[model samples]
Target: MAASVQGGRIGNLPAEANAFVGRQLELAEIAGLLGTERLVTLTGPGGVGKSRLALRAAHAAKAGLPGGAWLVELSELRDPDLLTNTVAQATRLTEQTLQPLLQAVCEHLAGAPVLLVLDTCEHVLDECARVVQELLANVPELRVLATSRQPLGVPGEHLLTVAPLPLGERDDAVSLFTARAAAAVPSFALTDANRADVAAVCARLDGIPLALELAAVRLRGFPLHRLLEGLDSRFDLLVSPARPRLARHQTLRTAIGWSHELCTPLERLLWARLSVFAGGWDVEAAEFVCHGGPLDAEEILALLASLTEKSIVTRDGDGAAVRYRMLDTVRSFGAEWLAGLGEVEAVRRRHRDYFRWIARQGEAEWLGPGQRMWAERLTAERANLRLAIEECLAAPEPETALELTGSLWFFWFACGFTEEGRGYLERALRRAPDGSGPEHTLAVWAHRLVTVVPEDLDAAESVSAAYVWLADERQLPVPALPLTGASLAVRGESARSAVLYGRVGQAPAADGGAEFFQLLTLALQAYLLASQAAFERCAAVAERLRTECAKRGELWMRGWGDFFVSLAGIGLGHSDEALLSAREALTAKWRVHDRLGAAAVADLLVAAQAARGEEELAARLLGISRRLWHAAGLPQLGRPDRTVFHREYERRLRASLGDARFAEVVREGWELGPDAAIALALGGVSDVSGP
Candidate 1:
């Protein structure tokens, strides 16, 4: 029942992998509360089923919510500063601007009907409360459902205490245990023979879902009677008659401890080391970070299988693409053991080092055939990468933080995480020592490149001078020559920009070769040529760049190449070729979520349509490009040279159609969303005049 909004799938409540046992009453009440309450908090102890209940209730309520329900998992998120960013990402509000992240999130949800679910807020309760309060105040139609050990304490919050499932003759707890036992042992069933033992185990564990599931998995090894005996012996002493709540806590801990005692020494060690990872980790990451010292690399897969069979770690995805994660409660238990072993810092350092290697690999291979794969891989590792950066910053030497941040320039630039990259780069640079080493310089220039604003033309010039001075002093090649050229082009110094681009083209590729940068330089050079009216040379340069990108399976830079070629085609009076290249560029840009590049190509489509005598289409596309420019948070392509084509095309369109009629069509185009606008510009839609 979840609806799609602006190319983003909004209702992302994860599907249940197992059958729902019970909680009919709780589900009904939570659904009813959501219908009335603007802010609902599900407060409970660890492993008390708060998250599962929240997901179920939200999934059931998605039909009434027009904006759809979204889950923002926060168990792995350690930094309170990124709370808003995490929420915005979960809601699919990819604001490609430098504005305050909180403001961006608020504005995106301003008048929209959305159900925002914040999962696992115990660690970052203060920030969650502040964000939830701000969102409720700003967006009248927004509803929040939060799961935490405690309440967020916002003014309008309605706390729903989620207790353990009831234990009775035929209650939820026994039903859950029976279901999981059937999964572990296909012959499992309940009859009068072993029914009493099942009920006793459920009662002893306080009807908590996780403890029951863990107990059920032991059925694969021991008979029902033996499992009950183990629980009674391990848990009976911990029970306290004075405090019922404390008893439940101690019971769950003892159950988990019983599970731990069942594991082999290697499995326990791996579990403890895996606590170093944030979010989830794949098999290769586990093999690297968790192996060594009594645990061999080859033994990891088997150990993982063993732990997974015991329900200590949960597996996600399938086959080769699978990843594993532990429940916060389970991971917290393991973290305690790891700390007791005095191996926390060592394991954390290994985690940091492993991801640092990943960043470098992504950077080195970014310009090659695996660009898209690397992009997706790095995006999936965002949480772990953040953890690595945090660990590095916490260490005595923070220089590795700069190195790691700098190595991800491609991810921050080519992917749609420019705002996030800017934040990390700024932080790393702030903590960077005063050194002119290659790593420090790369971080500095990479920061400048990602955070470049057209308004800061003077700063760009200063950075360019600094790069030149550093290169001369060290007798090294200017690493980011293409960025320097881009800065010059944005400054309207076309001649100097052309010279720098030409030099970049002629220079040998940097050591440890980045073909992405080389191809990008070629694209910039072609654009410079087109702006200078050298249409023939521009077309040639663009063709070479396009061919190179095709060989590498690269889309981001190739899209720029296509745009430059389209611009040259327009200049040379080849309208058909211009339209073809423009469409290709638009498609490529849309695939990569490159909004800025898509805007440029949309503007070119306006000119191409005008050249073909499609006056009405040109006017409509002009308006669409105007809207895209606004959405992209930049004005007029961020350069005068790029704006000239738009200005000239608009003047011609206005002259052809009267001001009143042109304004009417332009207004119509401005109303189309980005997806619809791209479809219209690509000629997939014949008529967009209908509301």
Candidate 2:
């Protein structure tokens, strides 16, 4: 542990033995995750010493990594766009091009192991997630330990959520305070004399290490109780306490301010512009904010590099595709600076414009092969989109509001963000002008999203009226925006679905292709309804629609169609065929990591098990299904009517002779057409006349 506390040092953790305490469990966890997995995120609230703890862990494990551990701090960088270059600089990489930077990073640490520490990454978490995913994909044998407020939420991310330090009944906050206080003043020991005052200081600061450290520094100037009194206006009062370290470590605010001041003017400007971003931002957003006049994206990469060199802006992880963010405290500092910059309106305008383009791209691609890709992208960009919505609402920008909401519908539905979808609709509908393209477009989107998931119909009705006018007055073609081919299929009334599908199917695609998905959906609905009318060719049409959907890679619907095909198979009296189809549906759901979809498939799986007379197997699968449903916070399907699905189970159960028993089955539904039949059937002979 021998080291000097001078300005420049390798790994930069305090060399003193007494400086590190607790985190044995955390160390073991970091060790385990890094030993096996490439990326591990240590997440907790701000000022919890995630960075210090990560530095210490890296110092401890540095020898294990022959290439030496490097810490990249990201709290100061205002632009998420340059996150990757920041890491490259931290590793002392000399590459200019992104490809070279990545290659240099990989080559430098290749065979020779290194722990890349990505610290204070919550705000730039999306960029961090992308970079981590990329690095882990490309860089072999390298590991990343990231510290953030929440998870990075990337695939295969191991979250080591750091909790506030364990406190004794008397408050570990005071113990920590006293220990750190004793470091500055040797005789400063905790006794009953000043215990109450010191304890008050710790509690007021909420057990955060930075706050505690700042509080401990006040012993040089004020009494413990006076320090407690001064915490009311914490930022102004306690942000500049006396400290042993440089001015940066004196107060929490000053520490952050010091970090920010180290950045260049462009980095500082980008940082301040980013104060408007609530959660996370990307490079594209940084370009939009930092460009236009003199400061164009033409020079953003170099500017991003300079900021990263000073350790103000940090690369999130190891990747060419990077994002950046600022800490809340740092973001606050940027906000303070941004207020006087006089480009608030212009910057916000650019923010709105960039996302409008993004929304347009999303709207165009939703029914294409990149549906899930866009779903994940929208999820990642939600914070930026939210900022756009808030900014547009406060300004003279009704169109932005409409486009923002309309662009996000697919994400809101596919990802099960039902309440979020509704909230966006309410805002868009309120802000929408009497006559505008955005208004008409978003109203339909708002309407369709509401209908898709059996949500409140109030929004749906208003949007439906808007849709009527859009077609009659504007004569806008089908699939204009919100009322796209896929959304129309999902949320539209069957009659409306038919009409819209008919129009979109005939309209030419952008590249002179066909809207085959729309046609396929219409054919399925026609075939399903036509069977009720005893149409002779209904089944044939259904089979053809399935083939066409398969040919077109209707990935989203194929999963659903699996269950529908099972029904078709049952209707055709092929029980084995139905079971196979249902099983495939369950497997697809699992493969795609769709827990909700898996739960939906669970209903089908139960039917498959029951129909085959596997009563025990049915109960077991139902048990698993219930647990999965509960975990997903979803209510169950109401008791299904025992039709071709449950008849075989009932027949076998009822006629079974001696030593056999049947129990009543319970089910859940939000009260649909099938439930009435289920209720009546279950009412007879206690749900079964079984043995």
Candidate 3:
């Protein structure tokens, strides 16, 4: 985990750096470091936010330091000799009695704990160093926090590197940008839909706080792609606007420009070339994508490592492989210049190929015994997947979009992304070539069925018919028509469904990669058949379907199959057996928030209680079920499922007591059917079922 930023107390930070994200660890580390070491220096490249960090730490420790604190902006100081004087002025040092100011300021500290924030000292490093060295020597109670591009090269200095924020950190750079963008456009929200571009921006800027803030601010006037294009040539593009900055902040562009001028031409070129990839690009990817006759893979990797140390390329510590990302603002600026000189298309294509290959590697891993491991691996590469989809579908390329959507389907639905999947699948079908459309449509509707099954039968039919028509038109070898037939059968189109399945026969034995639609079809058929009173056939089909989904590691579908098993347990009058399955159904319905499933399972619970002659328990459940039924929008009718519940409850209530005193209570209302049922339930009247 990274450090969290404490909001700054002393003023003058750039507006963008105000919302710090993904720095929880850094904040805690600095706070602790400041407590232990009075002289903690924050070091990083120019424009990498060292000053912002020092201010943040100082503000966080404001309460910790009772004597309060002072910010001495040293970036404005030109002469190395003036460092101590700036600190003296901020502390209200006297010109008359002060013994050479630095020593006088140290005495002014006077035993109270005080934190002195010194920002941007690289240009006047020697002077700033001399001041801090003497201050710590003379004043034991005064703490000094200095920010610079590099270390002060002084002894007793605890150097802390201030790195970039993470895109996944909702409190980080991407989130900051997205929030600012939303403020500009009310409809804008950081959805999985737009997280790719936002993360791309964060990644390109190496997640540097200042760059993300500017990119986010630019959302006010510039379209993302246009800004991205301009950012490509950042050296020429982000020109400090040649305008004055807020009184406190130097132009972030100017700060960055200084660093660019300091880098070797090769390093600068490599920096620009890296913008083509989205999210974080691994070193291997950088070498291969930005590879040229000048910089071989190994040499490019070495140069990138150097840039990492320079804080231009930020690293993500996820164990095994540490990934690197460039901040969006910086990458965009660099990419703009690189594109002007002409390298965008070649580099972007290489970036595309790298992730496309990665997607294939995920696919290969899914076929092995490590099913859970592969699922987690895909989950981790969510950013890379977004980049792949963006690189392919921003212009709606059929082949790449279709294949890319297919690879990520598992991760999407598993992670509660139904609405997002619908959007991309819609795009894929509209643009994908003739061959890719049908299979992808099948995959898309399969997920929809999982969410909308049994309730949205009408919509399910339309989606199912699309798949059927697509398959028939293509003359493709049909793999699992039974699944579709079974679904159609569930909605009472049994004749047509049976005919369709008879043509294709049952699906082959469910294997690791067999379409999930196949098992779901069998499971639904088993459930429907069991409900229609075919106990023997239902049991056989349900057992087979459960085995199939389980083998494929389809926990959700396996749970669905278990629902059918409970029906058999109910049909046989095995109360204990049914109770176990009923509890599982209870778990499943609640886990997925399936209200209808929950209501239906309540019927099973009431049945078990009635069978055991637990009148009091059954009566209490009956009352609850009545409310659940009305909530389910069920129709009121005699013999309506709920009426059956009332009759059973009253009959049990009377039988358990066999008391005449209660007979008058039931005689007025609440009984076997609606008029009689409601009457018997509410103590209005008695029915034949009532005592």
Question: Best candidate, lDDT-wise?
Answer: 1
Clashing pairs in 1: none
Give the least accurate 10-residue stretch of model 3, judged by summed lDDT. Answer: 682-691
lDDT of 2 by residue, 519-626 (tens): 434444533333233233444444555555576555445555565666566555565777777666655444333455556666666566566666655544454555
Those runs of model 2 whose alpha carbons end farther than 4 Å from true positions after fitting are 1-22, 25-246, 302-322, 432-438, 455-545, 570-598, 609-691
lDDT, candidate 3, 1-691, per-residue tens: 1111235443223344335545678889999988888888887766666766777777788767755677787766777776767777776564477246666777766567778888777667777878788878877787888887656767888988876666553547776677656765666677776667777766666666666656666666677767666666544433233135532334556666655654577888888888776667666678878888576777887788767655566777756556788766556657766888687777777777777676666555543344445444454555666776777776544677666665555444433344455566667656753554545665454444433333344455445555455445445444433445555555555566656556332444443444544665676567556535566677678778767766665444555566667666666666666656665654544343334444455566656656766555555545545554554443221122433334565676767756563353333222233334323222333331111
Query: In model 1, what lDDT does residue 512 have?
Result: 30
List ranges where model 3 is wrong by over 4 Å.
Answer: 1-33, 41-116, 121-142, 148-252, 258-270, 281-314, 321-327, 367-387, 393-398, 406-479, 489-507, 510-691
**Native RMSD of candidate 2 (Å):** 14.1
Whichever of 2 and 3 has more TM-score, that candidate is 2
Window of ten residues with lowest summed lDDT in model 2: 682-691
Alpha-carbon deviation at 231 in model 3, angstroms: 12
Question: In model 1, how many backbone clashes occur?
Answer: 0
Error of 2 at 254 (Å): 1.6
Q: Please, what are the lDDT tens digits per residue for candidate 1 over residues 46-88?
A: 6678888998888888878777788999876879989999988
